[model samples]
Target: MKFCYKNGILDWRIVVLVFLLYLLHALTVKILVVASIIAICESGILLFLALKRRLDLYLYTLVIILATTFEFPMFVDESLKFVPSIIMLPLISGYFFLLLSLWPLPKMLGNGSIWKTISKKFPFLFSFVSITLVLGIVMGVLSLFTDSTSKTFHFSFFVKDLMILGVFNVYALYFMYSSLIYPQFKQKLELIIFSVLVAMILAALFVSLVGAKGFYGTNEIMLMPLSFFFSTTIVFFLFYKKYSNNHFVLLIFLSCITFFMQFAYSNALGGKSWLVFFLILMTCLIFWYKRAKLKLILGSIVVFLLFPFLLNIVEKKTDGDSLSSSKLVQALSLVSVVDVDWYTNLPLSPKIRIEELLNTNLEFVKHPSFALFGKGFGGGHQDYRYAYGGYNPAAFSLEEYNNEYFIRMHESVNTIFLKFGLLGLVLSGTLLFRHCLVCNKSPWLVLGCLWFVFFWGYSSSLMSIGLSSLFIGIEDVRDK
Candidate 1:
């Protein structure tokens, strides 16, 4: 199913791809159905590719999983709307279909190899899991001490909640372990990486331009989708460092254009968006240098060219031209601070984050026991967020959810801290550390970890980071 190859240039296929995309736009009758159709059909294609033992299936699956994470057509604004959002419990996104598609995946794709890879290190992983198991039980008991803000509670369904903790809450272990076990396939995975990047960008652009309006129903286009896709796009751009200067330049150029287009859609994107782009830029400069200076310059050129277009679109789409000042949008965003000392006229959302994070950290100091094992899984910080809340557009936290004690943390680091404390932190930190350490060695693993930073607080992050430590003692096996 891969349209791009490792060797020769890809001009003709790109042209054909553009033509096909144009045709898709011409034929699109409904926008919401577009996501649904893409979800189902893409899975079918993946299933077919997996059964056929196609080499690029994993990367393509990775792209789709990411795509649906932020804006699957089925999205509805509600608390726990997506459900466990891990493997179960509540939220089901691209993972559900991806799990189904990959079950029949060929062993040549390393389906059986994972166990083989883990067999030698089973004892090590078992120890970690055993420790976590004890911790989990302790935490489960602790969960009993706290309340769920329910009226008449029934079964804790301890088993179910534990499963939720594993499958849904911290899902990243799925990829972290898999990639740790078998980081690379014996295929042109490198080219497939580029293909996946190109495909996702094109898809995102189409969605951004065409929107979620069709004869069937309409969905508002949002900034988060672009934020997720494009930030990863920049990471992928950095991943292209091994390739030619020409390729690197092209990726950054496209990434910049993607960012401008995203801004054109909505200028109200919060400060985190700015921080994310900064991280992307800084990551490139510190980790993958030399060409980064050039690429950033090129990106600025693209941004400059598209500046007027962005403003015009924003003026047309939004109610007033009086949004955030151009200078503010151009400069760094005033990110939320956890410190109570930090004070200024800011939005309620960041204030909520500051309150929640500050209070969550305080919980450990306030309750000496919590720092050891954490509030346990499913535990969270409660706040009267609504009392301070106002109309913060597109703020997920501001929504009337779960008695103001948002179960999910704004970031994975914080989430793990609230739930598992030092033990959980060590477990998660090890994974994050591994991926960050292997950022240069294992592009795939690094890719997963990087996104978890941007997409903290989902069970999906669990896929990338979990209790598994089977391969930690192996000493970064990919490069060596």
Candidate 2:
């Protein structure tokens, strides 16, 4: 296919079309579903084009979008609650598209120093998927031998978890293979990155102006893309160098946009504003690390101290008191550990989450098998409130409940332990270490990765598809 562009830049026309479709989804239900269908079709067509043209980055882009954004509601209740927005279609389609992308992997793997490095590191990469598959099989067999309806036996959970893991593994392989297959791949990769970032920023602003309506939930339409804008801007500024030029000017403008959006979101966060607050602070830390100015660090400390006051003002102005005046204070306070089971439906506080981590640690240490194999995939968490005969009317909605309902953990390492056991943790840690080691050549990328690691200790943002891509994309490009 022949393409035309002004000054050799990618055509912005496609971006405009996607943005219009995004707007139409918010305006009406029928249009929203239709637009989703069209978007999926576009991905399928793009996957084919990518395969034929050997453009693996485009293929990776489509897979990332499917995993991250394309959530089709298989079932939702009458009150618009209980949206089981499983990506079944994306899973099925992404599988085929991934297979197509991998058609040339064998040949690529047979050549190149990059390929050799990947081949040597392949076991660590494969270990995660292998452990997951083994756990699934063990759980399935246990379910068969024992009662299938046992609380620990979740067939749907096993299948869904495996499917997601499979897709992730496919993308990892493609990342490695494509880095070798394509020359000057970073330039091509960044073009797609900037294009996606610009489109998301424009669409987010449009949605915010239109009272935040979207085919997706209002909160999601506003939050997801804007969060990406906030995050990708940090990654870009940290890595890219063009001092006192248009690039730096543009960065300042975009930073202001993201700040206001996050500021507005600080109100009524169900006591979860600290996570967002920390991530933004980390972004600034990235900037300071890039230049290493003590003055900047001291200024950031003052701002951190004053941020609670700012949040309090925003909450007062919005007339929302869901978050306490002492929210930041409460976040820092520690409490004694409780003796609750790992799967209880306890009311969440910073204390409770910490206590649960303690409980998980105690249990895992007591029973070495639990530390080694875990309770098996999906056995780590349960609908504890329902299991304990408590109910909340808003349980079905995403934002209305506590963190435990969402299967969120205060620490990714703990979550990994419960889900994949010690072996998986070791493997994933090694892989991240490998990525970070390669990033010595790109100190800014190392800073970004470090920021993510810090965020993971407080929240599971690192597990999100967008952040995962950022974490992977930053280091995937070796120094040329």
> What is the lDDT of every predicted structure here?
0.45, 0.45
Q: What is the overall TM-score of model 1 with all chains considered together?
A: 0.61
Flag regions of model 1 displaced more than 4 Å: 1-4, 7-138, 145-148, 151-165, 168-193, 211-228, 235-241, 245-249, 267-270, 281-342, 365-367, 384-404, 433-446, 459-477
Whole-model alpha-carbon lDDT for candidate 2: 0.45
Residues 47-124, candidate 1: write the lDDT tens digits. Answer: 666566543454335433433333322222323133221132123443454354335234424566554554344333
Model 2 stretches with alpha carbons more than 4 Å out: 1-36, 46-117, 121-153, 214-239, 242-246, 265-297, 307-367, 381-411, 433-477
Top model number, TM-score: 2
Which tens-of-lDDT digit does each residue in 1-480 have in candidate 2? 232342332336545644664454333322345544655565567656655766564654453343224232311112332211123233353345435545655765466666457665455554554465566457534533432243333454444444454344545566555555665454444444444444555665666776743222212324232124233343345344431233455556655665555444322221343454465576567678788977888888887676556644654564524233334333423111232532232234454455445655664665565577655544444333232123333222232133332233445565556655777577668857766666534433443354344333221112233333433445444343
Q: Against the hidden reference, what TM-scores do the models get? A: 0.61, 0.66
